[model samples]
Target chain A: MSEPEKALAARSLASCHDCALVVRLPAGRAHVAARCPRCGAKVHRRKVDSLARTWALVITAAMLYVPANIYPVMTVTSLGKSQSDTIMSGAIYLLQHGMWPLALVVFVASVLVPLLKLAALSGLLISVQRGSSWRPRDRTRLYRITEVVGPWSMVDIYVVTILMALVSLGQLASIEAGLGAVFFAGVVILTLLAAESFDPRLIWDRAEASHARS
Target chain B: MPEADGREHASPAVADAVIEERSRLSIVWVIPIVAVLVGTWLAYRAFTERGPLVTITFESAAGLEAGKTKVKYKDVEIGAVEQIDLSADLSGVVVQARLGREATRYLTENTRFWVVRAQVSAGRVSGLSTLFSGAYIGIDPSTEGRPQRHFQGLPVAPVVTSDVPGRLFTLRAKAGGSLEVGSPVYYRSADVGDVVASELDESGNHVTVKVFLRAPHDQRVRKNTRFWNVSGIDLRLSPEGLELDTVSLTSLLIGGAAFDTPKDQDPGGPVEEGAVFELYPNRRAMLQPKLTVKRPFLLHFEGSVGGLVDGAPVEFRGIQVGEVRNVRLEFDADTNKLRIPVLIELQPERIALNSGGAVVSIGMDEVRRNWDDLVARGMRAQLQSGNLLTGQLAIGLDFHPDAPPAKINWDAPIPELPTIPSPIEELKTGLSQFVKRLSEVPLEQVGNNLNKTLEQLERTLASANALIAPDSEAGSELRRLLRDLADAAQSIRLLADHLEQHPEDLIRGKGAE
Candidate 1:
């Protein structure tokens, strides 16, 4: 094998996730979990059960996404007239009110981004489980993008909370968050946890295992 | 041997991966389970909070807007309009609303719904806040009847709702006049209630006015309480004098009713809700003592009955004992004369007889015997002018001993009372006698004597003028005698002056000087 083909695992060395300490591993006791010598964090070749954990969180997020879109996220009462709007409907309302830029921003951050993150995580999970030798660099880049963009979906939730706090003028005007906001917040948090639980190194592991087989 | 030594040393540093068999369920799976449980709970709560849908039909959709109008009870919102549709027959608009689950128990058959708008009525202004907040559906719920999901809306809001602590009373009137819903009801001139409704019965005979009397004041209503419409000023010119009566200023504008027990009557036990009472036109009419046992008597009057009218007081010894009911001119063909028949209702209750042992109420049978005795004793009915200014007349019952004796005619439809000629009839006879005396005087002889007397006075004035002529001899003789008498008087005056001066000087009377 070439020098680049010599992998870190083949050398039996691991870096601690918490302290970043490099340590040589003990030999041939696969049933026992390893710990960092310096910081004593659990050590593994890849995140332990990364696919299964990510699958569980991503499934939860997907389930929550439905109610988030179906139910009203917030209700705005102005001059005694109350109106309730869901996420997609809110964005559409902004569009209808001659605010296309705001509509685009809301649509992308609140709706499109979370959905795309869920899809990308699920894809990464399946590909890793199938032991695919696909382009590992591009797949890792996708994971990086999903992890970075997943939190911005909270823009809708922030707007709802801020409006609820600020626009309380009693009988004249008020704002209240609805049940969908709770579910939406759950989805955003779940997706974030799912992305954190995912291990990009598993993609390279799949590639290496397939390459070793070839 | 050297490769084995190096491998063994490397194995000490290299850790083997552990294939730990753990529960397949991950901790992360708990999030989804919790989320699912929460979702199920939310769904269940939503399902439970959902109330039944109700439909209300209104005559006009004046203040209703689909999905915008809210249903309120005492200003607290309990529901919202969901949809509005035209009725199948196109008679009105049907509104569908969904209420909160808390309101389910109050949806009853007697529940009333009405639109509350800014209304300016004769009695007062209401719902002014609705002008700014827009109209809303008002509900008066009653849990007494069967559960209902449909209702017919009232065209106007009821003046008094069932929620108010009050008793509903019914008043029957010959005419409604100015009374209407929202009119005030007064107890002794104090406003204590409102007219909830005024409607004509199916037969259109009388008006049925439903009034609500608020608590405490409602308890004042008794079985014998009199209700009178004090809607306007009551001005009357009677023998008592010009009098004006009114309840209050509000009653003058919006119309109102007042109730009280007559002074002489007993205010019986408290009346239940919806007790019916007669509505008199005025307080005087209501205060007129009601005598249940009335005996009607007919009188044939020989004099003019022009000034008497129906309802004129029939007085015994100047005290009102009855009322005149009817008066008609009938041609008595058998007698070949015209007669005036007057029907009078006499209340025996007004006359109490002290029978030495106890005061006995006069019954009809007793009244018959009494009438026969009185008529034999020359008790007669006469028309007397009650008010000379108004020229109104009243039937006066008195003992006219000089009247021709007569007995009660029991054979007539109504017992006939003996009648005597009124004073005006006596004056007519006296006036006719004077006219006859004036006509019987000897006019020709009186005119001749007056002419002779006038001629004699003219002759005497002519002789007196002739005696006073200036050129006659008696005038010249009188002039000479006057001159001789003046001279003689002057001499006598001189002598008397001398004597007076001497005597006054001697008596120290200096007045002579």
Candidate 2:
């Protein structure tokens, strides 16, 4: 094996004596007999299924993003009357009230954050798949942002829930949850999952391989 | 060394195991999923629950705003304003509102919509809705059929007095400042109606007014209803003092309306649409100066005498009922006529009643009737005065049984009672007249008779003087007689002495011898 492979193999198959599990280097390669599956006892190589499992989750998250935007999430009724306002409409309503800053916050947290996170995660996944030679620093920064902003994307969902719970007027008026809620929830969950499943080590692996060639 | 390395590896493995155990559950996805679910539910609720849209128009939008103002019924909010835009003509504002489905049924064609706010007045009920929501649209529901789109503006306030059904009569009077529209028409001092409208006639001579009464009272206003203006205070004077009659304090503060219905004949004719009735102002008679004497001057006379004093009737022509108003001696300068001017007020109505005259009569006819009565009754004028308490007077008419029938010269002054002479002036005149009569008597002849009588008296005195004169012949005879008398006297004295001596000196003859 080349010197870099040797180093990679050693680092990828580190052993945990207590659990008999293998603490592998963060990479896409598969290995057998790496650890005891039941006890996580130390072994010789890392599990080969980690990369595939992560990629599958990212794919599932991508599929849910479409329906989330198209459907409405809340339905409001007053005095035997009903109307549906989408995310954009609600933001516009707030904006018209001279609450532009608040509207911008809602827009960013609910819409822009979720979409950006999804796109960034997808890009990271694709780059990892291609083994692209990219700046480690840029990639780390992107990853940090995704982690920090991922939680805030649920702001729209939280706001909707809180409003629905608070504005329930028994017979005179009421607000009901719509189909869009479920789809939006799906999008949030899937995007979080996609972010979690991304492999940062893939970037390092490409760097190391390029370094060897140099 | 092998054992030490094994231990070191074991330590690392133990630490790694502990870390893995601590991080068993990755809750990040759960949090986002839950949040997304809630957000989705709320979004669904927002879209499906809106209401209907409606619009209202107002002459001036004023304080109304798109989303702030609400349509209210009995203070319950029924709708919210959606948008406010000026109409194309710019004469008014078109307000778009969102009516809750439940509240839409309340909007009807005849429903009245008006803006409500605070108002100030001296005697008004105001600021009723300020305690609730600020300014709002007040809706008054109507019983008309189906709901319609258009709405009518309601008057800001209710009318203080309304005329729906009542007796309509016109009051004709010389228009004065006191007689005005909205003046109280009082019946027995109670408010019954008000002057609704007033207008001047085309000739500018008369002001016609329309009055309205409320409720069952309207039925009481008959065609012949007498309408009078109650503009000033009604006063009655008595020994006690002056009494003022007016409505209650509240009515006094706001003024009042009044009217009365007569009991006897149903003066009720068809409601005369524009009947101009007589307006007898309480002060009209007092305000008017005596201009032209239409009828004989109304003299109010009064007198107090013993019960048996003359209670004779004052006869114009002697129909029998005009009573004496008063009897006072008047010295007339024009004719130098000393006569009693008896003040008398005759009730033409009573005369008309006895004669059964119509409501209105021509001046010529009335004058002719009076003339005929004057000729037959032997025209005599008298005075009359009303009761002290009432201040009403009527002239009585009666026959002058003692005096011959006197012809009445219409233009000449009516004959009055002879004025009794004042004692002082009568005595002075009598004395002057007696002196003049004495002067006219034949005193010259009386003076001659007096002369003859003086002569006879002088002769008698002369005879008397001769009989007793001392220097005359009678005086000489007297002297001789005196001598004889002296001698006789001496002899008689001696005899009387001898007789006294002789107890009964015989008889007085002896003395004489």
Candidate 3:
């Protein structure tokens, strides 16, 4: 295995996020606020309060996931008969009706994807919060996966919107969005922000701090 | 050297970075708080908006889909059927349904549920729209009575819903006939209501028909109103003539009832809802004068009482005053004879005491005294032919001054009245006596004497024929004499003929020709 590289904080150097200008930081205090001389921008050694912000968003998204799966996402009325379907129930209904392929797609995109993303984000948060230096490489990979797949959970909300807009033929046949759609949308958007606000470099900072202490 | 110079130049311009402390709580925490508030609110609303689940037991689940059927009241949906299961006993299906939150207040014991389907009956056609829209459960909600979640569904839709403004009346009849749910109730040739139910009374002796009369028309019913079955054509062959009566063609097809207060009597007081009225079979029977007080009397007859029956009229001077209770044959042990005792009940109301032609109420003691006095004055009960064609008999009370004196048997259960033989009975007795006298003659001896006389007459005729034979000497003389007489008769006839002509000719003077 290659030798682990030394961190930039150990070299007493911090780069400006806006202008990429390297500046010498005041040593021995990583919490100090600094300004870049080249672009007049506030700079930090890591995203400002990355753990707390991502934790707040992830907690919110996790809270919203409950109602998203509990309540009905949409109600479809056709030929004087009406039916309401939640995400999991819609998948089950499709599967029962001999359309396993469509069921698989819906299950993976709407239910499984959001659930896995929350788990990955929460795992990354706990490991970073605990200051564990174990497998920092895999933790970064998990963060990337959560970021890339977080938006796909919005597939259910889009289906609901398109069906509601297109199927509004008065009383004969109509589609209506339910409260679940709002909560589900919140989960999708919050998870995306949680992934965005997460600092992957924090994964290495913990390892570097542990290594220097040892 | 370039890095060392740059660091020496940058070190002079670079200042220490400023550090500041901020609030521990981040504003991003608001997202989760808003989510908690919204999620809690959504859950609370969902919990509150859900209504109670009710189970209804029905005879069958026909036209009922597990989740498709909706329960509606007055055309507005109030609930939906959620699931269906077979009853434990397997006699019926139990339907579980979820009702709207507001429907909780009206789920009472009297709330009715029935399946609504297209129906065509004799008097009504309903729910035609259900044919295309499919069948659905119907509800007639009632807020009265105890709240109940379990219910027994009705097999058929009710004839009268509670929303209709009406009053109910009960009619007791001998038979149900064609009266059924939805049968019309008529007033003065117009349909005013419908028969809601026709059920047999618990005793099974008669039918109890419940009718609903619409408002305004319902007020027309009075205490003294007479209700009669106007079903089918009423053809009566009465003493007046052949009579035909009917209310309407609709009533003629489907059974119906009609009510009216007689013109001569008062309409009486307004009746309360569910007032019971006796249903008469016909208008004539309903119009019979109502009598409150009756006194029964028995009359023993020695002659046959063949035509007399229960309900036979008892008359006083050709006017009906009572009806026969029954005609019975009894063995009179005291007299050692079989006698027919006819029981009749007299209505005291029909008899008016004339004090200068004014009716006065007579007490029983006064009536007994008067009756005794009348019997002493030769009042007699006799059997009379009421209808010659029908051979129906009636009891006639009339004065018979020559009748032997008799007394009323007041010791009997029903006071016995004295009776005299009817005129027809006397005529029958006379004809039977005449037949007895005619039968006494010896008809066979008379026929034998007549036969002997005829044989003697035949022998005399044969002897006379032999004496007058054509070949005998006496016969020849008689023939010659007969010829001479013929010649004289011919000459006389010619002379008379000539004289007759000459007499007319002489008067006209033959010399003038």
Candidate 4:
């Protein structure tokens, strides 16, 4: 049976998110803060303000992304002359230098992956907010992909940091992190948290609501 | 809250998670808000980094391209070209450049812009390294000039910068020789500088060469410094023998300039920039000149000055104080006399009037006064062969102690100095006088006397021949004398034989040893 079809009859079971324990709640128990028998941790139907928190965090991440790609991530100084490159431009520089594979990896992690994660999170939020469940299973899979790939966008931040440390040669050559690197890192972390707060069962809730309406 | 909302949503509603019990806006919204602030800062920085725009016009845009070619000063890139187009006159290309913010402080009216290309000029080679990196515009901004945005480009790159230690000087020549732009300037056989530029003077009567004499070398230039054309081989066949003369072998082929400053206590300080100096035709000419020409005169002659050429010296007695400006043969129709008029330049400074080596200009009036006195003293100008083998004639001015008295004709059309016959003319006159005296003798009387003398001489010769005849009485007497001499010789030989045997006997008769 599909997940939504199975969730249709699940009003008596309470799953402990902390200890992974399954117990039966009293009949007609509603909105009760209960402790897991094994872990003694408070349990609820879903994460507190899961959709609202995810929405706020995703919007923040999307806003921060504007500056992340607009400004240069780091500056490279050689022979007393300095040149700064944005993430996209750095990727283009790599491509122009005949390192297409490295360029693609940077593009996917630094630019494309973040944008795709933001879009996927927004898609899931919109689908759940509309109480429309066209494909709950597919929607859940999209959220899973978004959560997994969200942290990879921080690759650019790590690259900048390592280059700054390893390439410091006093006046000969040095790499310094630019203001954009901070915002880009912030976007990555916020997006990861947004994906974390996003509730997959909200999608199934929509599916159940549609079934009930019919 | 979501569980309570969802449990309540079981009664009525669109069962999506909507927690209505709390404020709608979450604290997570500040992340996006902070990101917006950072974005605004980044946009401001991007806009502020750009500087003012400048436009430059060049003759050609051969290697320049928009956004690719950079404008550099001292190897530092300060701007980039943004646009290029043909100028309104279609005579050149105009380029617009956008400078970085830091470059704004250095833009000035005297900022010279030149495209750096690998160039080989007549005197210099530059920008070889630019061949790899490609051509770029180079700037030199002089601080003395005011600020400017628009500029006209340099046609040729200037080889020397103002910071380069050198002094510029102008050497004016009668004609432009083989001196090219990169020709060496030698001082005492050492190459010190190069000919940076050469052009005709405004009057176009002379060629003026611009030279950069580098420091230490430049200090060697004095106001009295003499420059000469160190070009061409000077091969002169003189009475001595064949001669080859040149300042240097390289100068003989490519041409060059050599300057020497006579050591003086003053040396007129160091030579000033743009100080004008005459370029002597050759090294010999430079050695002959002690001062510039201060006085000029025209002397007319009735005799031939065939070998006298331009630049020939006019010596007073044996000292050279002037030079021959020109020699021309002209006919005086009124007098029906062929007069050779010679123009000469006399530098009175060659003579130390005060014995202090002071170059005194005894004015033209003083010269005229001396001319009257010299005429009274029978001073005259003559053309003498300077080199007999080469037949080069130089003008000579000397005082003839016994010449006929002649007065200066002050009323003549041109200035007339009294003339005296040359030594050659005097010899010719003496010969002609002898011929006239010879012709003045009574030829008939002398012929009669000569005939009488010849008759007497013939009689004496006939008598001598008759006496010396083999059968004559004198011949017979000589033969008899010869026979007696042979008899006497025979007796003498017998006496000598007796003495040879009794030589000891004669010594003993004297002392019996």
Report the number of the highest-DockQ candidate: 3
Docking class of 4: incorrect
Residue B423 displacement (Å), model 4: 6.0
Candidates arranged by lDDT, highest first: 1, 3, 4, 2
| TM-score, prediction 4 | 0.65
lDDT of 1 at A100: 99
Residues forming the 10-long window of minimal summed lDDT in candidate 1 chain A: A1-10
Per-candidate alpha-carbon RMSD to the true structure: 8.1, 16.4, 7.3, 10.3
* Candidate number with the higher lDDT (1 or 2): 1
> How would you class the docking of model 2?
incorrect
| DockQ of prediction 1 | 0.30
Best of the two (2, 3) by lDDT: 3
lDDT of 3 by residue, B86-130 (tens): 999999999999999999988999888889988987667898867
State the number of backbone clashes in model 1: 10
Q: Which candidate is the best by TM-score?
A: 1
| Model with the higher DockQ, candidate 2 or 3 | 3
CA RMSD (A), model 2: 16.4
DockQ order, best first, reads 3, 1, 4, 2
Query: In candidate 1, how many Å is residue B368 off?
Result: 5.0
Q: Residue B251's C-alpha lDDT in candidate 1?
A: 88
Candidate 3 lDDT over A61-96, as tens digits, reads 899889888888988877556677888999999999
Q: List the residue pairs that clash in candidate 1.
A: A25-B13, A25-B14, A25-B15, A26-B14, A26-B15, A27-B14, A30-B17, A30-B18, A30-B19, A31-B18
In angstroms and one decimal each, the interface RMSD of every candidate reads 4.2, 11.2, 3.6, 9.3
| Global lDDT of each candidate | 0.85, 0.58, 0.85, 0.78
